[model samples]
Target: MPAEAGISGGSCPDFIFPPAETPASDGMTHPRNPLAAPVPLFYTCPMLTTLAIRDVVLIEALDLEFGPGLGTLTGETGAGKSILLDSLGLALGTRADSGLVRTGAAQAMVSAGFDLPADHPAFALLAENGFDADPGEALVIRRVVKADGGSRAFVNDQPASAATLRELGGMLVEIHGQHDDRGLINPRGHRALLDAFGRLDVAGVAAAHAAWRTAEDALEAARTDIENAARDREWLDHAVEELNRFGPEPGEEATLAAERADMQKGAKLADDLVAVGAHLDGSDGGLAALRQAARRLDRIAPEHPLLADALAALDRAVIEASEAEDKLAAAAEAMRFDPARLETVETRLFELRALARKHRVDPDALADLRDELAARLDRIEAGDAGLARLEAAARDARAAYLTLAEALSEARRAAAVRLDAAVATELAPLKLDAARFRTVVETLPESGWSPAGRDRVEFEIATNPGAPFAPLMKIASGGELSRFILALKVALAEQGSATTMIFDEIDRGVGGAVASAIGERLKRLASGAQLLVVTHSPQVAARGASHWLIAKSHDGLVTRTGVRPLGADERQEEIARMLSGAEITAEARAQAMRLLEAA
Candidate 1:
């Protein structure tokens, strides 16, 4: 199917919403979820309240106040209408340069004030970014452009960057033109517009995408680990087995060396133990002699009291000798050594040292190295299982993402149905009744999937019957494109955040009834927000709720451009002038009167 030619009627076939299944009609009944809470009215829409421009291009000094409802700016071809828009653009954070300043002026200044509802999001954003804005009053944005092309920006009297000004401006106003860089024409904003229309929870889809990516990352990491570990698997296994066989224990080397030293010392002490043992228990030793003398004295002790006392002293000395001998015997027994056990311990200690040297580690650290190697081997053994688990998680995550994306796609299709019907209704009024607008949502290939979703969305159009539909940017003429943009703005107005909508000569080529239809639509579009149109059509000018006249004048020595709000009579005269060139006639005034009345 061609881009926009995929659908025939306003009904979207892929839409799964309740009321969206019905065919397109002039009027649509959007389905409300029963579980959804009733919407509470918060802030009234914001509008452009004041604009001041000085030394800007042809505009020397200009101040304009805007109220609610549809307003029109009427001027001759080169009467500085573009200056007004450019000044507003400057205030809205457009690039500032010397070209914008008047030829003789040193600098230029553009300031815009907006009357926004107290609950407007811009205030919160300002607070978040540390910009002071009094929510109770109007929001002000000011820009200064110097002759040297330097620029400065301020919001609510607080110094700010151009980006801040641009953000605030985006929420405050939307300017639509044939070649505007902002607004609904930009393809980047199409998805958001559709989601807003559908009232879909796009954040949910984003979260799902994030989850999917996380899972993908986890799986990839696991696979990479496996690949890396495979290269070292053989060495790791051999090292682990060797360490296990040696069975190195903490402090084993030091303990074994201390035992070996003790055994060597005991061997040297064995001779000394033998000599001491012989003296203690020898037959002719002092203890044996003492024992014999004590027995003789014991036998004669009854005959003499002195002899008895001497015998008792000898007996005490002999007892002391026997105790000494017993201690020597025990000491000798303790000195006994096992040579085979000592040799085994020495061999084991040497092996441990050799293994430590092989691994380039201290003997004390061998145990830790062994444990680390074991852990690595275990991980390699578990690699296949871990990879399988990660793969399962990735699959689950992808499923979750697909589910959310499919649901979001269904919601967008439903929204497209209502949007198409709404825009379709706007076509005849804008003199593009033969044209068709479509929100094309095509599923992308898996490789092309991103965080945004698995779909590509574009706004497409067909200008004439039987013509192949193409991208809106490629197919529509400049005038037709502007009208289409206007229709889309009207269709999405309720969902739009901007409080002010400006059209820079959207009514460029059309006249007669087509211009009248554009005026009527503009009036309808201005019901809740503010609308400002730069137009040459008398019919459109006559329908203005408020009118401003832009004209260039010569003040003797200088040329200047001035704009002022016109009264009822002035408005009538301006409209008459638009209808009858330089000469305003009675017939033209009558027609202007009729047009104003009809409007």
Candidate 2:
């Protein structure tokens, strides 16, 4: 065995074993040759490559490297073993409180590095957020907690936010703390986990839901328009008919008013033009009178020089009067016989003016109003048909969505049956043989429906026979909850992301065979992914493929915490110490030896 006696404690080695080559298997089964005796297989999975923590709580400075398989952290109470987990949680972006910083320390820093498989989702998440990460290198996560309760986070040496750290950390490591708020305890995640377990078509359901929502929106809009149109149907119908009868055109009012003005002015100018024509061209008018005077002056001019000048002036007056007579005749003709036409124009103009006044708009706007009213009336008529069509579409969309959701729900229920059975097997081994694990699948009301589906999935348990099941969070005692969490984790280990799993003393209240059972399950879980367990049970600690010891040391001035990997000898000593406390007896050492050999 690699963990032999007499090897001193130091940093964990950078070596890991590969997974056994075999057919697919679940937590309860391991594949092997049919005729061969059961042989345990050691395998490596994604691991926390290293952790460098400084000035965090009780720890002053620490650097640790972790190998694959179950790496157990063992120490006496108050040895600051938990500070390692606390620092790791801090680096994973947990909320930093002021007390996490050591006394007189300016700030505490924790940095963790992970070695992951090429296809780990953390790589995808990092790429999606434009962060630099290489699968070939260790992915680094760092956090700084100041004495004043302020904090900062970084990823791969690039500045990042706490949220980013939390999100990415969740994909890389799952820390199942004693608190309910951490890990898979939250009910909100239950449905998704169930879906993942069942391999249900989540994207299909989401698409169907989106389609249904779109249909609902369209239906609501159509209904609103129809309702509004119904309220104005009567007025709109009347308006449409009236405007159609009026047959108003763009700029018609201005055109008709102009025509009316021309007709009235022509009528007023007719008499004046006729009177001027009579004065210029009638027998007693200016032209004839000028002609008579010119003839008399011409006859006297031959006899007198003064009469010659007068004859020339009379001839010019006769020509001027003739030109004036022709212009007056033209003007009189243009103004004549338009009184009946003027009456027609005035009637039409008045009608248009009245229409404009009734509609409370300019005459120029009449055509636009007519078209608008016509369109509205059309919609009012079409709304009934449109509303019916949209309603049908909405119904179809809802039915389609429900079909998929119902199918997914059925699949989840089936998966829950298997999950419950699988976890039931784990419970008995963990010393909860009488406890019942149940996955409740209940349909949500319409008001509670969401894109995920209409079913509410919750994990519940009954700790005793014939007891009604309640939510896991309400289990009351922390020990039972932790055990229940452990069972659930073991059952679903094959379904989640490629993350390093951490169980913080989940085997706190159990021992002997129960602790050994937990250890066996933890080893099984490690076959799929790396596992870090903080445990006080020698049975559990002995099962570890690798082990670490956390201890406190003081130089008389200040106290500090430290962690070091236990070699073969150190592991046995630690396990013996765990079995018998500070004073180790020969029986305890022998038992620890037997436990290591069994592991």
Candidate 3:
């Protein structure tokens, strides 16, 4: 068989162990099985296709290509296996240190290339960060660390920040180890994982929560308004009443001022008119004298032409004087003024101005102030009915939210039970038969509620019988912790998992069947996605569809670390070398063949 035959486009038959009976809600016995029934592999192309490292620690220059399925990396201690991971981490935007550069190199550079699906979340993230990313195009992230302790990051050759690279890295890869703090190890992500596993829909609950908050905000605002209005209730009533009795109109102040000025001027003009009237009224005035002169001149005008002209001039003077006296009589009639009416207008103007001063507003704005005060008084009187309606709305919203949250909580508890049972079946084959796994689903108080609902989920474990269960990190040994993480991953079947997963020394302490079990589970996980495992176990190495041997070599005065892909024969020889220390024996070779055949 070819060395990489099972690397892609293949499946392994499901291994059926003795069933561990779990009670179901239907009162029937169900088999708790960790190894799911065989399904076709979903991914044939690797997401991460290439990694290139330059002048990073002992790696002078290295470029590696990868394929889908399990790829094992094995080397002796201090043979630079960790260096490869560190180089990958640099490209993934981990914190950079100047010391990561080679001894005499000016800088270190690392690039990672990926063939992500068009619908991957990283594309959305890139767009949100102002980077133009097209679907169906290759993605490459590069990082350069300078010897002077400065670093720069790039995505597909475009300038990018390290923070962006970090976020993208989170979506692309998950690294699980004894000390890993992200992915399945973090409690903050536990609830989300559980929901994904159970395929629970949380949109309804989230929508209800938002509605409740909005209603509560409206109700609280109404209550505050009613309280403030009540505090000024008596003042509002008095102000409204005073302004209603003295109804002011817009432009009323300007009109009154104009009228008062006209009346004052009229009073002075009336006195002048009286003196002028005396001169135009009597029969001995200018009018009568001009008429008498014209009549005497008319009789003598017939005697000569000059006499006739003089007579015409006297007749015109008489007519002009009579018109003047008529106009005087009309003025005297129209300029008549009453002291009582003037007093009334002045009194009204004074009251309006005083009211404007009391309200600290312009005279014309007093009308608006009156309406506002009346509205306030109206609200204070009608507050109870309005408050009652708002209170009912808030109550209904709260009840709706509680209903959705309670249903979600119940679903989570049921999923937790199933997850615990699935995890239990994985424990025994990995040689933790005495240990027990538990998924805690606890309900938090209302204040702790979130859009996700009010349940807090955590995965806990106990290593021995009758022992108290604690968090996996706190209770399990380093080797046991790695195994526990593997068990959890196997049960989850990659639900909520990243596209590529890496395991560092997951098979550290165990040997024989336990090592074989770990290899089987890793191989099963790789059938659907891609995995890179850094391991020392020969069984784990034998299970890989592709093998890489990491080694340290020296030239003249410089030492470098290198990785070499193994062919069929070379893979057997390497596995034998891993089986027998320092030298490969015939028996070890035969045993390696058997392991490969079994895989």
Candidate 4:
């Protein structure tokens, strides 16, 4: 609901089809400014020539030339039109028909020459497939079928595969049939159709979807981090508390405790042992006897210094004995221990050691690791702000998408109005006055849109309004489907384009004015692009600016189909025969003239 950029607020880039100056297709919506139309082709290609073939289906040594305008192929049932189409398809790299080679020929060959502009899209394809070119020469593609059913392709003499041939072939031509409805009917292809239809809003929806993904990813990461960090907060707090209380400094308490414990256990025994040692040394009682002897020695040796030295030695010995007695008293006084303090130190050390064992780490690492865990917990607590930012981004993205989608919806509605009116006009002459055809414009939720917008526009019909609306493809019978396709092709003209459009028996089950209407539509379609139609009606056949008659022939053992470009008199004769059935009556000839004149 937020304010989004306005529709066409210089946002959607305008599409301008360039070769410039094809009129704004009258079939589609006409804005004040229209895109340029590409230049039309001037048929110069050597694409399949009815001119030459070898052992291919019912076609052999057949020669045919097509024009830039609509070309119709007409023949009696089973007379070989399908075979010609098959051969063309083969040269284009379609699957092989090993059994289709002429009755006795070793292989089949389908060759086509194309005359295209120097910058033609098809030319690029030919070159990409490794075909050589002579600057102005038209492209040549050929497929050869071996006797054993194997097939090979060549582009301008360079060996190529059937796949490469098919790819290039598809670009150059499109063959359509009632059952081959791939482009307009498939929902998977709808997005591209809308894009070509100039619906720019779908792009906005895609942008929004992308923004949503990115924002969602960021939000998820933040949530995970918060959960992990928060989960450890209680444990981290406990660890820091334990470390703080212990106050384990470097080795001081451990040294004091060790010394005290050793002294307490040994002090009493040591005191009694020291008293015994003093008695043995005669330090406490025979001191006077030793002193009197030392003095007599000093008198007798008055003339000898050795006697005097001996008296000094005795005095030194007495001083050392007194010093030893003082040391023993000190040792005895220092042996007392305090149980309360000892128990405290031992418990703290045990706690550190036990924690280390439980955690599989060294005791020294506990404090540093505690700080890291605490930091992680704090980070988790901070993720809420990031999640808020993501929510905001997703909102903005959706808003942007909706804004664009609305504008695209409006454009589609406008196109729908014009399209319905035009198709109705086309269908009226085809004997469907009661048929109500419409371009259904429904506004769907944003999820339905691509980059173009949230509008699902389906070409629908109420064979009668009381009946439920059904898509054109779903309800129309074969003949009706053909008519409907013509109406749409006429309504769209060439700007609403496809790479190829094929019509198989679109002319079946209709004649007179209805057939004429079909012909006009085909002509209109051709003006916009290429159209290949198969017809049994002379009216449809006569309308083609170019003509190919599919005929079957027997030469000895082979029954084959052949195609040829009809000369003017021959075209008239063919149309006459169509009007008069199996016989070419004069009346039918006159009618053919009138039809060609009106066309």
Residues 1-599, model 1: lDDT tens digits = 01221211121122122222223764545553332232222346578899999999888898899988889999999999988998998999887768999989999999999987778888999999998788899888999999987899999888999988888888888887666757676677788777765656778888988998999998897677567667888988888899989889999999988877767766888888777777767787777888888988888899988888898888888898888888877665554567897789789989989999999998989999989877656666888888788889999999999998898887778777767776886788788989888888888899977777777777888999988788766754767887888787667644534658898888888999889988877876676568899999998888889999999999897889999999988988899999999999999999999999999
- lDDT of every model, 2 decimals: 0.80, 0.77, 0.81, 0.64
**Which candidate should be chosen as best, given TM-score against the real structure?**
3
Please write out the lDDT profile of model 3 over residues 304-324, one tens digit for every residue: 999999988888877777787
Stretches off by above 4 angstroms in model 3 are: 1-46, 227-382
Q: Which stretches of candidate 4 lie over 4 Å from their true place?
A: 1-53, 91-97, 111-171, 190-382, 440-449, 455-457, 462-467
Q: What is the C-alpha local distance difference test score of candidate 1?
A: 0.80
Q: In candidate 4, what are the lDDT values of residues 244-345, reduced to their tens digit?
A: 565434454456557657555544466575564456345334344555666777677677788778878876665665566556556555544445665665
- TM per model? 0.66, 0.66, 0.70, 0.59
Better of 2 and 3 by TM-score: 3
Model 4, residue 306: what's the lDDT?
Answer: 82
Error of 3 at 447 (Å): 0.9
Q: Residues 233-324, candidate 2, lDDT per residue (tens digit)?
A: 88878888888887888888888887777566777787777677677676787788889888877777989877898888878888777777
Cα shift from native, residue 114, model 3 (Å): 2.0
Highest lDDT: which candidate? 3
Minimal lDDT window, size 10, model 4: 1-10
